[model samples]
Target chain A: MSQDLVFGLYIFALATFVGYQVISRVPPLLHTPLMSGTNAISGISLVASLVVAGEHHDRFAAVLGFIAVTAASINVVGGFMITDRMLRMFNKKKAPALAKAGS
Target chain B: MRESLINLAYLVASVLFILCLRGLSSPEQGRRGILLGELGMLIAVVATLFKAEIVSFEWIIAGAILGSLIGTAISLKIPMTQMPERIALSHAFGGLATSLVGIAEFHRMRDMADAAATVVAVAASEHALNRLTMGSLGFEVFLGSLTFTGSLMAFGKLQGFITGAPVTWKGQNVMNFAAFAGVIGLLVYQVIFLTAAPQWMFFTMCAVGFSLGVLAVLPIGGADMPVVISLLNSYAGLAACATGFALRSNILIISGALDGSSGLLLSILMSKAMNRSFANVLFGAFGTGGGAAAALPVGQAAKGYNEATVEDAAAVLTASQSVIVVPGYGMAVSQAQHAVRDLATALEKRGTEVKYAIHPVAGRMPGHMNVLLAEANISYDALFDLEMINDDFARTDAVIVVGANDVVNPGAKTDAASPIFGMPVFNVEQARSVIVLKRSMNTGFSGVDNELFYMPNTMMVLGDAKKTLISLFGAVKGDGH
Candidate 1:
């Protein structure tokens, strides 16, 4: 019934629709790069949630915000760390030879 | 009131989520992106709990405690080898959470009128319109539920708990299409009868969606796991976005959207690496029993292949001016990457130019050989691709192959009747001398014996890859060559 509530809901809906549109068109070829990229975005979410929790006067909202903050933080940090470890495998050294043609 | 501050925090969190996504595109700056995401969620959660109107904290506290314990346990227990499975499982959890959120939001909306008599007059006007309005809650529930089941199936398949074969019949595609049609039909019905015939229709749609997940993943084999994992990850993100929409949370919407798009792109990349179409991966029985049944008969005259001892192998390497090493899955299975790297170092010290030649698909997984070498801290410059080093093989004094079978088969390029013919291969036989380390003359995953073994320049160092490499390194060191 409130104008603020209505506006908030509209923003959420618009973001969701736009987000899905962007997601569906993403070519599977770009998955890992995109995942690592989006993980950084998840990190930003964690920061914003923390700041929001700090600024909030309502104890309940702040606590809920904190929980979300923690979850997203773990997702972003651990996700990237694992991704880096995975990427390191793309570089390896060559093997050695066994015998000569005429010994 | 303080709502303004909470709203401001929400806006900021949304912006950070956007930035975090952008940063993750590059390997160099990915860590920063992760940090930004952490900050955003922290802000969002803090702001949400600041709501003054909400009085109860017990439920939230209990939920947080339980979630943290489970999360921590999963995080600590999972091994690096099973990281892909763990990632899929995390996506499943995200999907499950979104689905639950959607259900709770729907229930809350339904009970709103009855619980608060203060808004009865306003409720009557909204109630009449609500009956005709399509609630986001239903959409979120549908998508989230699908994501939850789909991700679980992907995880199971990746973990080897479930078969990675597509369980399809002659009319499987038709059935899948019908399922899609059924979901759409159920969705339309739900929109019209928002409050009526809830249980049966809801359950039916869920079942169809779940079956669709199984159908979508069943056709893909284990070899195409990376693509499947990424695809399921995208589904999980979309589910989260749907939940955000239902709950009217901007932060969730933005973050989920970023995750969803990234997942889709990763899937595309993985598909390209296999040189297969996305549809083929989804429906074709690729890398299944195709390579498992055919066993190439080994040549009885194995005289030329395993004719060299460690000292003989040492003699060849000792005279070489240049040596190029080629490693394969056998290297990984034998845990010989480090040993091979050490041998290369010793060869270089003996005034022999040593370089590593790598094939694109040399190991079990993409970049498997590369990872093994990197773990040994091998210089990045010493590693060369097949195209780059193939020509040099002929000029090199020796080509030492460790625990490799298929990649160096020579049959792939030389034998027209060979099953893997036309597949690109490393020209290991071109080198002046070739030494192969192996425990037996067993054919590789392609189930074909390597023709390179018969080459005059090639000699098999029969033993484990690690042991052979170590012995060869020791011999080279002792010879003082």
Candidate 2:
């Protein structure tokens, strides 16, 4: 394998471990937000889509890139917003004091 | 310098995403985590805009603006009760974007090979498709296509646009298997014989992957949607990872892995909560043919059961000191979270301690009940998971199961013959008194009879759960005492 591919595999392996560690510790109460949050971050594919849309490729590739960008943008924008909305609602009865205590 | 800056932004974004999940480990800091994630996304997008290769900006700008408008509207308008459908649709969007990117990359690679071949007067076959890039592209397109259609199917079921029952036919499993195998075969063929593969082979793989998605989700009953949705979440992430490989982007790989692992772990937890294997959930057609047995349990046939009126339930609630509410998918169907909150409030007014017990597989997705209850303004701190509150049921004054059945069923513990036998359930049977709010005497989505419903101490209040909760709310607060 090329060094670049090997490097990516290293990143993938280590990130997967870190993801499991972080995500597994998340309380079930926050699971819905977790799913949506990771989803929004997965829109990192937007970077690649950006290249495809503006790389001066053929019109056909550009069309595909345009649609891809639109879809990914929705996941990023909507996913994060909805996740934030949901997370904001998860509060202790004594919102100010108890939030600090609980954390 | 610009390339290094882009890479630096991505590295920072990766760390922010990690911290975002870390923040989700508690509810108190969850919103802050989401804010951090949004900032990371903003930075990554802005940096990508500075990439040297991007010569045109019109399409990107237009698509981003239009998408932002639609996304903001959706996020603002969607009620918490529709969270499952909202989540499912987002998965679909993620899938669509990843697959389209994969297709575009493949197109570019092919064009590059064609140009090189023309210059050298050689065949494109020998020049096209290095093993690693081709492998990643093939996997990306296949997984992305499947996730797109699979999530759409899940959304339809959760939204009631399609039947929640498992849709099965003769040889359904076999057909699904064949289609899945065919797609994998095409992918393998492309990877192994990279030189001789036709473009149509790749498109055919995409087509088969799309159909396989529908077939895979078709036989999964609504009761198992938590697992299905989680699995789709994982698939969407993996597709993104594959896109990263094809593009040699480290940031994409990192975020994709995080998302993929998160989804996979949730799927595993959900499946474990229901005591089912991944294979069983995917192909078991669990609720099929079980409905016939479920229909056998009707009103008043079982002598130990008490059919209580709204007055009796209200009186019971009013008399109780501590009450625990167990919500199920039924609560979501009837949109009873607000009513439930109101009842809890009334009970609290009377000095009755009210807490919510949430089973892992209680609703359409993981944390489904928590989100709905939170939207109803109930404190997350007041909600307890099965393990935390299962032992407390014995000490509670009364237990109210609203629009929930299977999770509280005692059958899961004592009856080995039961389909849900190995699953952990609430010990509501150990409470002082139990009131179950259900529509008619129908068994839950699993079609298994709940022995708890037939116990002497349990009272079945048959009606719409929302209406019943509302009436109970009135009776408790009416001051006839």
Q: Chain A structural similarity (TM-score) per candidate? A: 0.53, 0.88
**Against the true structure, candidate 1 has what lDDT?**
0.61
lDDT of each: 0.61, 0.89
lDDT of 1 by residue, A1-103 (tens): 5453466457655655655455444322123434544543433333333333344334544554455444544554455455555445434234333223222
Report the TM-score of candidate 1, chain A only. 0.53
lDDT of 1 by residue, B177-293 (tens): 788888778878876665553546755766676677767666666556666767766676666655555445566666666677666656665565444678877776654245432
Largest lDDT belongs to which candidate? Answer: 2
Error of 2 at B279 (Å): 0.7
Among incorrect, acceptable, medium and high, the docking class of model 1 is incorrect
Worst 10 residues of 2 chain A by lDDT: A94-103
Error of 2 at B347 (Å): 1.2
